[model samples]
Target: MELENVIDAAVEEVLGLAQGWLGWDGRPVVFDGNAWTPHKSLRRVTDHLVDHLAEIMCRLNGLDPLPDHWHGRTVTTHADFARFTETDLEEATSRLTRLALMYRAGLRGLDPAVLDARPDPDTWTLREVVEHVAGVVYYARAMS
Candidate 1:
């Protein structure tokens, strides 16, 4: 499947599962040794998306990717334990849907040759980067 489709599906699935998180039992779910509350999961997925998008932008601009300060994958913040509400769900949906669209449009604008090329042996190709972030479905699934 195309990388864009992979991201779209993941984002959709995450948002779908997130709908039921309003009734969260006020406990974190353990996944890969990380504690995942609804806020933490949403934060992780958004961070992952923005991080990769920054990488793509930096590479295209002949610059290095910005360093990420995200520690959500391991550190559970106090805010992470907050209640999940209908308002939060709506915000998440709007935020993630726009991010997914940006991801898709960004990838689609790149030349096919550039998408597959590995300019830096140290990093994954652009397509691979997109595919990697598509795995964000795991974050949302932890809420189930």
Candidate 2:
């Protein structure tokens, strides 16, 4: 399958599961030795997509990627503890869907050679990066 198709499918699945959290109680669920709430899962998935997107863009432009200081799955803010409502679900759907589409557009714009070329020996190729983002299904899957 194409990388973009895989990413789109993963994001769609995440959002579908997130829709199930519309009336979630204000309790954190433990998963893989970490706590996960609806907000936290959404935030993490969004952040992961954005972070790697930035990295891909910067590498394509021959620039150093900015450091990401995201707290990730470790810190759950007060807002993360909020009740998951229909409004939040709508916002997540909008934000994540757009981001996933952006990834598709960006990947489509790149040359196939560039997709396979690593920015550095230690860095992942753009294709690998997209696959990594697709793996973020685990976040939403855990919450579901």
Q: Which parts of model 2 are misplaced by more than 4 Å?
A: none
Check candidate 2 and list the clashing pairs.
Answer: none
Q: What TM-score goes with each of the models? A: 0.93, 0.95
Q: Pairs clashing in candidate 1?
A: none
What does each candidate score in C-alpha RMSD? 1.3, 1.1
State residue 141's C-alpha deviation in candidate 2, in Å: 1.3
Model 2, range 1-144, lDDT digits (tens) per residue?
A: 887677789899999999888878878899988889999999999999999989987887889999889888888788888988899999998998899888888888567898898766988888988998898889998787
User: Global lDDT of each model?
Assistant: 0.87, 0.87
Q: State the TM-score for model 2.
A: 0.95
Candidate 1 lDDT at 43 equals 91
For candidate 2, what is the lDDT?
0.87
